[model samples]
Target: MSNLEIRDLHVTVETEAGTKEILKGVDLTINSGETHAIMGPNGSGKSTLAYSIAGHPKYTITQGSVTLDGEDILGLTVDERARAGLFLAMQYPVEVPGVSVSNFLRTAKTAIDGQAPKLRTWARDVNTAMERVDMDPEMANRSLNEGFSGGEKKRHEIVQLELLNPKFAILDETDSGLDIDALRIVSDGVNRYSAQGDRGVLLITHYTRILRYIKPDHVHVFVAGRVAEQGGAELAERLEAEGYDRYVKAARAGV
Candidate 1:
């Protein structure tokens, strides 16, 4: 099925005081070629869920499981999960001072493929990936995400998406901190990547504006770390009109 299944998962972060449970018995599944939007207020554990799935070290999965195509992925390492066909577009991508864009992308492409592409042939494809994302070919020579505009960094992420071609992508607030034109460019690249066959997208956003461009097949309201409600595209419209108070209350009641 090439689908991702997150089954009754609970997450807790360790601290000096003790463990604090964040996600409480969350169950969700997404199949290929579909886009699912996760909308939530702040501190609802939306990003926590995204990072946990991507195998970040801080958040720990205390119970339940996550799987890709029925294979348990909870045991895999961060890079191992990437190689297993999962991608996370962070809200704030890091800046590496010395690493060039081409170098970073080449390493990622190599890791995804599990072997290096021929050096001569690889150079041509890297430029092609840049062009597809509307990135300047000259930027490829600059250090990774260093001294770039907000839009530039976001577009670079899309270039990685095109090059990596992961089966499932969790976009964690990709639309945040962007201007109108930048938002359009970022959404365009996201749409292009989502067009591929059997590629699933799980987009996390606080605003519904980006949904207009990407047109999610389904929309989910995440409250206190679990999906409070789920419906089709119309759900997004309702959220835009009314806001999240009603859903948050319902979620608090365990409805």
Candidate 2:
């Protein structure tokens, strides 16, 4: 079984004002066959935690260590991290004007596997993944996310997750902008990935709706850049009922 561990993670970013810290001494751990949900209000650093662990250059890790199965990952490059079995499904997937979805997926798969996928098997696999996400097969021929709807983009992200089959997947607001149908589709894809029984998932979201479809093993309430509270699935039920008001007030009052 594999594990992803974050310890005392402090991250910062340069804004117009100056270097502003985003994640304040945050810590989290995700193990194989487990899913963890991070819930909080806006600006509580939920996405920051996801991007920080993915080795985004925009965010700097001032203090902390992120390790995958005892190997230090903070020192790896973004692509290196992907090759190391980490996958990130962005909240807003960027458009690649010239790259077709087919090419992009094959290229990414090759990068992570160190060899190109066999053309026959690769084509069949891509089709299967797209079908699982309810995405049209023709989309594989279009430029990646260039003219797709938000639901399509999110669905494409899931396709990648299935094809790559990473050890750990960090999904940042995947449920955003999704309608009921799209949400269920995306959630099912995520569920299929986690159902592999050896994959870990870190799902970050402001709402618990997605949790209804994909239940998490643990739930964390993030406030003021730290995990103010954490518990089982019941914690998510509480957040859905009480909201983050208590946590927000406590954080502001320095409680």
Q: Which candidate leads the pack in lDDT? A: 2
The digit string of per-residue lDDT tens for model 2 on 69-115 reads: 99999999999999999999999999999999999999999999999
Flag clash pairs in model 1.
none
- Deviation from native of the Cα of residue 160 in model 1, angstroms: 0.3
Local lDDT at 152 for model 1: 82
**For each candidate, what is the lDDT?**
0.89, 0.96
**Residue pairs in candidate 2 whose N, alpha carbon or C atoms collide under 3 angstroms:** none
Per-residue lDDT for 1-255 in model 1, tens only?
489999999999887899988898788899998999999899998999999999999998989999999999999999999999999999999999999998898898888897888888877878887777678888999999999887788888888887898999999999988888878888988888888868999999999999889999989888988888899999999989999999788877877
Q: Worst ten-residue run, lDDT, model 1?
A: 125-134
Q: lDDT (0-100) at residue 189 of candidate 1? A: 83
